[model samples]
Target chain A: MTVRDPKQWRLLETGLRRAAENFAIDRALLESHQAGTSPHTLRFLRFHPSALLGFHQNVEQELNLDYIRAHDIDIQRRLTGGGAIYFAPEHLGWELFLDKAVLGTADMTVIARRICEAAAAGLSSLGVDARFRPRNDIEVDGRKISGTGGAFDGDSILYQGTVLVAFDVERMLRVLRIPAEKLSDKAIASAGERVVSLQGLLGSPPALDTVRQALATAFGQAFGALFETESQLNPAELPLYEDALAEIDCNDWIYQRNRPETEAPMREAIHRCRGGTLRCGVVLDEPRQRLNQVWITGDFFAAPRRLVVDLESALRNTALVDLERNVGRFFDGYPVQMMMLGPDDFAAAIRSAVASVPEPVDG
Target chain B: MQACNGCEFIGTLYYDPEFQIWVRREQNGSLTVGMTDISQTVAGKILHVRVRRPGTRRPAGKPVATVESGKWAGPVPNYFDCVIIEGNPAVLADPPLLNADPYGAWISRVEPTLGADLALADFLTGETAFAGYCERVRNEGIQCERRTG
Candidate 1:
């Protein structure tokens, strides 16, 4: 087989598809690329109303199965890591399959930053001040607009993201097991405050073609490469895709890690410090003794506001015993000016939330 | 145990620098597999680890376990053909142990299917080999933390 120039990348626009097909293609492309049978590629995909979970996540812990079944939302597990998300045709998915050598470093964090910055730049070109928030989020003025995650096999890597072109906060809250008690107007309004969409920001959704072009342009500029559109998967990837589809499009694959919701309880607490009131929401993985994710939202004042989100990112997946140390370390190096509060206060707030839950019994 | 550039290395273990995995042969012929300290540092604090169940045979370079850090996720591949014997329950329960005490937090135990001569032939061993590992650490600009109390 004749090899294309390494500097030239393929752009595959596999428009609207179910989560199964999209993920199968993800496997096929990443495997083919790793096997040296395909060129580095960028793929754009759209999901048909799906509820997706991270590869290692427990479906029961992350989603409201009753609501998902009632609404007929397709459930699938992502090949990458992160929290669960609600995806629909209104959301645009972007992915890159490339050799790790192209990034010049084996540090995944650096690679994530570079790719997120490029994607954020693409969004910024669309007239929003999109910025790469540390640890896999793109936010415009502190409101998340895109979330990204990645997976690697040997020397090959696949990094993917979802851009909220038009998002439904209520629908997302319903699909995911956020607080059921928070289904009231106050909660929906508060949920709306945390995320932003292109349609919401621009008054109307921009053309899909325009968004694709902006992203393609940004990637080309960032990596100094030219992209050529590919109509379909390469011949070698056909069998790979078929096998992947057969393996992925099954109930077994989707519910492989079926931990109970009781193992992961969402706990919240309010702590009033000298600086301000800090409210923290924590999803504690009781069996594993870890914190899956934490959301800190309150009337806290800090000079660099992103510090709160960064701290939350640092605390993600932290062992319950190490929470205070991690929080203290997070602030030790970070230069932040909060009115009268210190890192200990943030630690205290998270600890308070965690303390509300009973410790899991030893097996 | 010996240290280089703040990264620890056990003298008796064999190292696959490319994969950043260390293998220790037990008296019972099973081998213990765990990621090197440099790897845990580079990958950041690990979030979750899921090992393939016992009795599952895998070919060389196939994943024995999947590991996820806060920002990245990937596999912990075996360097040789082997059948998994057991996964470390401690590491499975609290993944941060891989970051805090990687050597103690072995990922899995596997019995190599390859012949003894060929099984560990490619792995680096001894003091001279460990020096090379340290050189790679320096060359890669790996920053291993001096864990504070």
Candidate 2:
């Protein structure tokens, strides 16, 4: 199939909306595009303080519901795959709806990397040194600024990401069930070390329109296409949006996967080595006996602080049995200079956390 | 078993190349469904697998199971209308088994509904299945990678 119009695409800006409405539009646009009723689109969206879960994620396992309820933050599940994220009005959401054939590649990793690189280019246009990290993140100076994911149905695909324009990191820490300590100054500082916002980096947030234009220009140059801005949904997309809203704006859809929180527990362990005390916080999936996520923070003096983040990335979604081996391989490959720390220290720290809890008996 | 374009397909099972799923008829007349090697390779590593509970009736082309990877997630569609009888506990416990040996890892078992045809014209078997899969892989420009433990 040849390109319908190689140099032309639609640019859509759906202003701030409730979480369910945004997700409804997500389904409506992707489904319509898949059915060949909608044009190739680039959409910019924002949410009014929502906590979104990945499609496959269980709500109880990923969020602090009590906090979310008290704060009146809307909770909705995303159509994409990844971890949970907190969305705010100031966060600029950008998405591209295109057919896989347009990219001339069927590999998801390659496609994600291409789109993330383009987004990184857009951020760079704001005078920030942003670069694409592996998997799905755009970071500047080793601090993540944008996180991305995608959902595909048939030939159509929707790849979307959030740009932290003027984010509230403290609220994010409260809403998501992360591995860090809860609601402490130290934890908030630790979280700040990893995530950065446009306001934090630039001293003031860029206007939403400016951010959208930069992204549009970057995507246009990347795909060699011209954007025709549309302020409303295409006529073909309205009926689909209504159908999606009817199905998605309800408790049945929002709480579809409500597993018990005990199934995924945060276990912490502190290992005292000759170098220093290394503390590890691990979110373990007891049913599958796998590490859902791992975070290490300690007083150890390891040069190149980014190494810790890289190690954490390597350990994400790793099997418990393979923890040591994977950690060993990461240390072996990375060039690090530590005063008294050895690779074994990191491995032992994680193992200590795993062994802290007794294995649950099979039912 | 036969190998085509680096993907292995069981000789006895029926395959739907368009949906990228394999179906096996059990001795008890039920059918087992799983993803093909081409599907798993294109999807990358399998991180999670969720199968529909038993006693649910679904139409053809609907999801019997959903598989997620690090970057991609989608449903494993059944080619014929059926009622799900059981989900594979082994695959649910360890999803990477689907990537390690997609042929050996069945995702769900279902009993065909009344008036549903057991043998569809698109279902392929033996050498015909192998050739069709190879052609599809070529057309999609996919290179199957050997699974590691």
Candidate 3:
């Protein structure tokens, strides 16, 4: 197999655009580039204050749509699978429009990682010591500097990411209905742990141009390809972009295609004892009949106090039936000193909490 | 390797996809599928892979393999209803084998009871695979440099 030279790829900076327009361009360019008509290209784009959810995400569960509407922030759905996100002017978006052939495979997921880690390398080039976090995040010391995802068809794929040159965690707290995210300082602190942006870490956000250059340079190095700056959209892409934007820009395009939010209940169950009151809120993936997320919070006294955090991580996206087994399995391995807190007690708290809810079955 | 038409593998593999693990079926009466290079590209140096065991009936479209990347759970599914014929427990215990040699490692052995599906066709190669890819790109909204292969 032969690889394309660096000079073969192109780069474009498509300034601020609406979410639909951006997504449509993703569709158009990925299709064209993979068809052999467009060059393997990297595009730098920006969004005007939006709260977007991954394709598989539920709106009500992932976002506070009311808050977005009131704030005049755009609400859009990304054509990728991952968590929902809040993007604003403070963030920069970067995407790759390339063929699977260039990456050398037809696997969509693999393409995302290749691009993300390369971007992570670019961040590293920027002296951020950034690293790729599995599934879909680039983090700096465990706090994400960028979050990415993609949509693909055949060989053409669109892998896009949000570079947090700057971020607004407070607005994110309001835009996404992350349960108890704003309830307290600790809760907000927890939210901060899960996300990070440039301004928050560096005191000042770098220029957008600098970040884009780092990314392009990093990707070029990763692929051993040269990137020539260009500002051109191929003819093959216009019609597809138009059609996609038309459908994507409208509410009908975004909503009414998905199952109801009630299918994924944000059910909560709590248990209290001397150790601490454990509050377990679960978002069920009804189709798979599993716990999409398990949030365990409590006023408990446990050493390596990140035990709850680890436990939450251990049980993430687990099937409900596997919940108890996972919890027991977790305790058996993790050596933690919990005063007045037993393994079974913690498991029982979560199990009973799940049972208490007559969760709405998938209709 | 090119037995079933233009079926092919691209350059150096990378682990860089979202949940970058998957199962593909080949007609050798056994599946010849594994993770793509790009999947490993972004996995940030995969620590391990946990493929499903042979004789384990993984229903169509469900995870038949579980790979761990950066301590996050990544699921790889058999695109069709499958029965594992051969899988490596050795690699399962060490996971990086999938990243080190994705195509050579061949994650699992499953015979798609329904044969290979068309949806799986795009990922796999047949005669004219490259041309088909080119067609896909032509439809996308991106400008390109000319190609002559």
Candidate 4:
């Protein structure tokens, strides 16, 4: 397919590239467009096995470098927000390069939802139940089918995400900090509950072409435009890509500019409750003097699985004293179900952990 | 709020004569810095503001913080050495605040170990900052909060 007009959004498929190259191309296109040298684009890319951290994330805490190196997985940091994600050749990646004028809003969170909802409509057309989950994720039922993030400049924008046509939870555990690291049979099951894949949904991975076509169609409708396939980067973007790739592909580009990972110890608190054993992994955000990430797991049954995921995300990165307020606020509006599990139980577990260091006092 | 000499930079900016630099915030005798209004118009609608952690280290004349919007990402280039002060767990929570109050709701602040008062003096303000702001406003398509000179 050939693009005849610069205004017409172009669609291109860049076969699997290392994380750096793919991300560098992202930088190049966004930069070129910001400089008023490039056009709106839709790109389909695939990643060689890699674990990616968010732009502001600490590498040490987010990834399992040993597993990444031994498995020959590429590691890179994203230019967006949210948590870390594990990407590989098996998952299909999609990105939209457009001007913010198309969306009529400057808010990233709102932009994320509009794009996800449109993609959900496209996914729904493919006979799969897909919907946009708040704060920037697309899911089938309550399980995540797509995770996304975005970057913007001047008027040009790049919002991207991956759909798990095929994925491995066990491999992800090796690359990420799982809620439970016991590595026992129980650990694997626990990890499975937290993540789901398309293969598990369809009994086999969807073909690559089918996934791309669906995404392209989704994006086309989302933007109310037509997509004509192309084979290369825009000429204006080539020079920029080269420059960006040079910086990002090397160690200094990757690690030289980074801060020492925020090494908040993974402290655990076992609270004996009549209902069940509640185990919490509590971490502190030293900079904010707050409770960063918290995981509550152990023979716990919660209804509306999204509630658990939402609760975890709510408390995932919160301040210590702010814990009770956050939990209470989340329950105040969020529809969650745990017959015996109360907000106080949640607050108690977090309080027990915050009591240890007492923050600024000790350190 | 404690008395501090800081000026607001709207879509287009003006620098105060009394203060050479637009102090983002004053903390423990340190200055937090960021771009003025004239900067954001050129930058575009901020999609995401990614700042280093509070304890994150930095050298002067470095890209300490990064802001992303409309698919483009650029460093919030700084003119002084700094370290992020404790507050705001993640930039994602209130990224727009960077634009709403770029100087007040700063991206990050330097703890001012090496250069404090000296660097602040050299920072832009008055007719000089206003001139710089106008150039940015025109070069990068943007409207001003008030009619500029």
Candidate 5:
């Protein structure tokens, strides 16, 4: 097999667009790259206010559609898979479309890490101490600044991430179907502790151009590629983009996986332990036997308070049966001091919450 | 079974190396398909699997189902044009089965619209083909392991 020259790459800055249009371009570019009709590229994009769902996610289960509809936020599905997110115009999106061979590995985990590290480095150059968090996040002092995911076809792959240049916690809370407690004024502060934007860290967000330049330079350094600026979609992609837009910008595509909200219900549990009380809120997907989201709160003394946040991250989208293993793996690698808490306490709290879900009564 | 670095390939099933899926022809002219063990190993801890509805006609190379793991998401593309006959409810409800038992947790049952023989000809089966498949796996440095909760 022959490899494409790493020295040649394209840099595209696709300014703000609607969710449907952005997702359509995603399909077009990925398919074009796979067909060898386009060059390896790095694209920067921004979106108008939108509530985006992961490809396999149900819009009804993931977003608070009532709020979104009232607020005029576009609802669309991402080609990539991960949890849902609220994307505002202030958020900057970056993506890399490349041949998998250039990465020197086909292992998706390794590929995600490599790209995220470079993106983290880019953010670091903009003045904060950014690091790549395992799975898919970029953080500074344990608060996430970016979240990433990927989708692949044949020999090509498209990995994308969203950088929160600025954010609106209240609007996001309204747009996403998170735990209701998070909507309270007090809990809003707690939500802020989990995610930080460039504005919060730097006092003022840098210009979008500067951020884009930093990322382009970092990627160039990492892959040893010289990026040539491209202003428009390639000829092959134009036709493809139109077709994708027609298919994607419709109710059929937006509601492709609209499972009922009843399938996912919020269940809360409180566990009393020697350390303290741990409150766990689980959004359970009963049919799939999966935990869609988990929120851990209550009186617990874990030094480097990020421990709870990171633990919660580990449990996201986790299989109920793998709860212990995931918890054990997270605790084994993390070095933190808890007043009277241990790894089992954390796991037990979540398990208790899961077990508390009432059995459905047959009609 | 042909094994390489813990990856197992059952001799009776035909394999599509590109898609990394195994196809087993059923008695009723339908076929059952699942991801190869190597693919399950690479995907790691399957999180979600959504299959196309039964009766949906899909062209070759189109997604019969989409699979998501902790870090990756991609299609389980059929190797030939086919109409989905049935999707495995067991795997749909419990995705980890893909990682725990790749062979037993078949993804979909479908009827081929194209000539089955021509499609089968493109797939690898038998001991000799398995040897070649294992050799390719070795060259790619793929290590398959069974992960259970």
Candidate 6:
């Protein structure tokens, strides 16, 4: 069915909700849009302190349950794919529900880049020099401002992202098990180098309305469509949302993918490099022979400190066999200054962490 | 293996190009299913995979497995109504193996539901599989890249 108003789309503003409610809307809207009962939509959402896991992630593998329970933070799994993240009232969530035909490409990578570029444009309109980082992050001067991911069914797709308005890096560190040091001033500073908020980038946080308008307008221009603001879910979407809520609001659904913490072991290695002691903590997926995540920290001094985070991001989900080449490629293109540290030093740090594990027998 | 428009298709397996899934009928009347090279190429590097546990029953076209890549997550629909007999442990442990060896990595095994025949007209094998893949590649502008370490 062709769109009656090719130049028109709906803009949904669902104000602050609990994690389960937000995810319920995610399911209902994506399914309804795929069924052709709903129009293309750009939704703005807010959450009340929630710890969201990627759909396939295990809670124990990603979050600090004890702290989360103590703080009374809600937990829910996102329909989109990516790593886990901490959300609060200060963050703004933006989602787009459309079809593959609308994007004119079946390639998920290209689709992500296009959406992220548009989101980056919207952030830029807010006076931040935001750019789309490869894979799925929107950054300004190497510090990430927004992270995005997508979930698709048939021809329809739901792509969503978080825009940090007045972020609390310390609270995030407490919520997610990122293998970083405890929430100290130094650790917070380190976390701040990788993530930036609107309030942090600008002197003060922009109004929520202004943030929404900037993003909606930028998306409108990107898709060549006009947005008609809607405050409520359409009639066809309400029941669907309820059904989804019933399924997603319970622990059974949230913990459906529970895996043992032992499976994802944190292997730490200390490498005494010429520059400094480069310490690496790797979350190794032993059975897969893959690096689930990498964290580099030490008494090292590398100029443009964001490089460490960038290198860590580069090695995330990389195969053990590709470690050297991946690090080599990252350094080959990334311009950085270090007194005596080289790309091999980083590789060695990761290798040392991998060496902690015994070789896997053939299947 | 037969190469068609940059995609490699195993001659021994029956493929449904429209769904980008391949099925192999085992001697015990069970079918092993997995995504094809074209699907893996379009999906990019996979980070997580979850197949329906054994004893779960699903209709034809229903998802038997869900795969998540860097930016995308979606279902891997089966070609026939079946009850899952087993989920591949290796693929569950390491999803990137799907991209590394699409044909060799089976995601799940399932027995056909009652009254469902294994020989469906939609299933393509041998030369017909290559031809179907070729047509899809042309229409979809798909460029398959072999996964290399």
Best by TM-score: 5
State the TM-score, rounded to 2 decimals, of chain A in model 4: 0.91
Looking at chain B only, the TM-scores across the models are 0.93, 0.90, 0.61, 0.67, 0.94, 0.91
Q: Using DockQ, give the best candidate's number.
A: 6
RMSD of each: 3.3, 2.9, 11.6, 8.2, 2.5, 3.5
Tell me the spans in candidate 1 whose CA falls farther than 4 Å from its real position: A1-4, A269-279, A297-311, A330-349, A357-363, B2-4, B17-19, B146-149
Which pairs of residues clash in candidate 1, taking residues 3 or more apart in a chain or in different chains?
Answer: none
When candidate 1 is compared with the true two-chain complex, its DockQ is 0.54
DockQ of each two-chain model = 0.54, 0.59, 0.04, 0.13, 0.63, 0.72
Regions of model 5 farther than 4 Å from truth: A1-4, A321-325, A355-363
Model 6 C-alpha lDDT per residue in residues A73-117, reported as the tens digit of each score: 999999999889999998999999988888888899999999999
Model with the higher lDDT, candidate 1 or 2 = 1
Cα lDDT tens digits, model 5, A1-363, are: 434566799998889999999999999999898788888999999999999888889988888888888999999999998989999999999999997788888888889999999999999999999999998999999999999999988778899999999989999889988777678897788889889999999999899999999999999999889999987998999999999999999999989888877788777788899999988888888886788888888887987878888888878878788888899999899899998989899889888878786423212
Error of 5 at A190 (Å): 1.2
Clash count of each predicted structure: 0, 0, 47, 16, 0, 0
lDDT (Cα, tens digit) per residue for candidate 1, span B4-110? 78888888888885738888888888889998988888777677799998999989878899998764678885779999999999888877778888788899999
Q: Rank the candidates by TM-score, best first.
A: 5, 2, 6, 1, 4, 3
Better of 2 and 3 by lDDT: 2
- What overall lDDT, based on C-alpha atoms, would model 6 receive against the true structure? 0.86
Model 2 chain A poorest 10 in a row by lDDT: A354-363
lDDT (Cα, tens digit) per residue for candidate 3, span A1-363: 225352468788878888888878876786566455667888998888888876645566677767788999988877655567888876888887776567765434466678888999998877777887656778887676788776554445677888888766777888876565345688777667767777777778888888888898899888878877877576777887898888789887576335566766666677887777877767775655666577777677776645665677667666677677888888999889988878877777777656666455322
Model 1 over residues A159-248: C-alpha lDDT tens digits?
999999998999998998765445778667766877899999999999888899999999888888799898799999999999999999
Across all models, the iRMS values in order are 2.1, 1.5, 11.5, 8.3, 1.6, 1.3
Per residue, candidate 4 scores C-alpha lDDT tens digits across B1-149 of 11111223442222333121245435467665555554554444454566666787677645567776433455665556667664444345556555565555655556765656665555555456655655544443345331110
Better of 1 and 2 by DockQ: 2
Q: In CAPRI terms, where does candidate 4 land?
A: incorrect
Candidate 2 whole-model C-alpha lDDT, 0 to 1: 0.85
Report model 3's interface C-alpha RMSD after superposition on the true interface residues: 11.5
Top candidate (lDDT): 5
